[model samples]
Every structure is written in structure tokens, then in C-alpha cells.
Target: MGRLSTHILDTSNGRPAKGVRIELFALEGDKRHPVATEMTNADGRTDAPLMTGATFRTGTFELLFHVGEYFRSFGAPLSDPPFLDVVPIRFSIAEPDGHYHVPLLVSPWSYSTYRGS
Candidate 1:
């Protein structure tokens, strides 16, 4: 069975980025449709897979991470307008039954992501 999952790590804090907001979107042509909105738990991961089973498909998608709000909540010293605010990661799924783990390592200043196991 194929599934989509994600997690956030606060590289600056050396811990999971708890309570960050994540928005999922499915892109079709030039339009983006909202799929789901999830928040990171204590482990900096969603409670369940973002997409699975019938809901999971091979197509283009985007994951929007609200890192600015997350840093502010913890009193991180950032400029009036944070350098890295809402981080948008756009990717595509090619296999119908492959697990896609997109994990984000981020901070108020910068961020990175990759296709994990």
C-alpha cells in the first residue's frame, strides 16, 4: 500500500518542531486544490499518514510548512518578516504503491527537505 508522510525537525533547536502547521495541496494544471491541513504533534509528526490507500495517487502535490508562526510561538528572535516563513515543497509521486516520506529540517533562517524511506 502506498502512503504519504512527513515530519519536521528544528535544526536550530536540535529537536522535533512541534506544533507547526502543515497544509497539503494537490496541483492540477495551474490550479491547486486543498487536500488537508495538519499540525505537528509532540513528535513533530502528523498523527497519521497525510495520504493513503484510495486517497493516495501518482501526481504533483505541495506541502506548505508554517515555520514562521512556529518560531514565534517559541519566542525565537526573528526579523519583523521572517526570512523563511511559509515553506512550500512541491513534489511528484511516480509509483502507485510506494511509500513517500518527505521530512523537513528547518529553522527560522533556513530549511531543507528530502525524499526519505
Candidate 2:
């Protein structure tokens, strides 16, 4: 079965980012449809796969990570307007039956992501 999953790491603090809000969206051309909203757990992972089974399909998708709010809660010394607010990672999936792991390594000022196992 195919599935989509994600996790976040607080690069600044060198730990799993817990309680971060993540939003999933499916994109079609100029349209973006809401898919799922999830919160990272203690392990920086969602309780369940964001997309799985029949809902998992091949196409473009976006994962929005609310890192600014998370940093503020932890009292990170961010600027009045943080350099990195809501981080958006957009990518495409070509194989419907392949497991796709998208992990975000983020800080108050920067973030990066890549397709993982």
C-alpha cells in the first residue's frame, strides 16, 4: 500500500519538534484543495499517515509547517517578524504505490526538506 508521512526536527534546538501544526494540500493546476491537518506528536511525527490507501494518489502536494508559532511557544529569540514563518514544501509523487517520507529540518531562520525513506 502507498502512504504519505512527515516529521519535523528543530534544527536550532537539535530535537524533535513537537506540537507543530502541519497542513496537507493537493494541487491541481491552479487549484489547491485541502487534504488534512495534523499536529506533530512527541516524536515529531503525526499519529497516522496523512495520506494512505485509496486517498494516496500520484500528483503534486504541499505540506505547510507552522514553525513560527512553534518557535514562539518555546521562546526562541526570533525577530519581530521571523525570517521563516510558515514553511511550505511542495513536491510531486509519481508512483501511487510507493511510500513517500517527507521530513523537514527547520529552524527559526531556515528550513530544508527532502524525500526520505
The candidate scoring highest on lDDT is 1
lDDT of 2 at 74: 76
Question: What lDDT score belongs to each candidate, Candidate 1 first?
Answer: 0.96, 0.95
- For 41-63, candidate 1 gives per-residue lDDT tens digits of 99999999999999999999999
Q: Show model 1 residue runs off by greater than 4 Å.
A: none
Considering summed lDDT, which 10 consecutive residues are worst modelled in model 1? 74-83
TM-score of candidate 2 to 2 decimals: 0.98
Against the hidden reference, what TM-scores do the models get?
0.98, 0.98
Reference-based lDDT, residue 64, model 1: 99
- Prediction 1 global C-alpha lDDT: 0.96
Clashing pairs in 2: none
Q: Candidate 2 on 1-39: residue-level lDDT in tens?
A: 999999999998999999999999999999999999999
Root mean square deviation (Cα) for candidate 2: 0.6
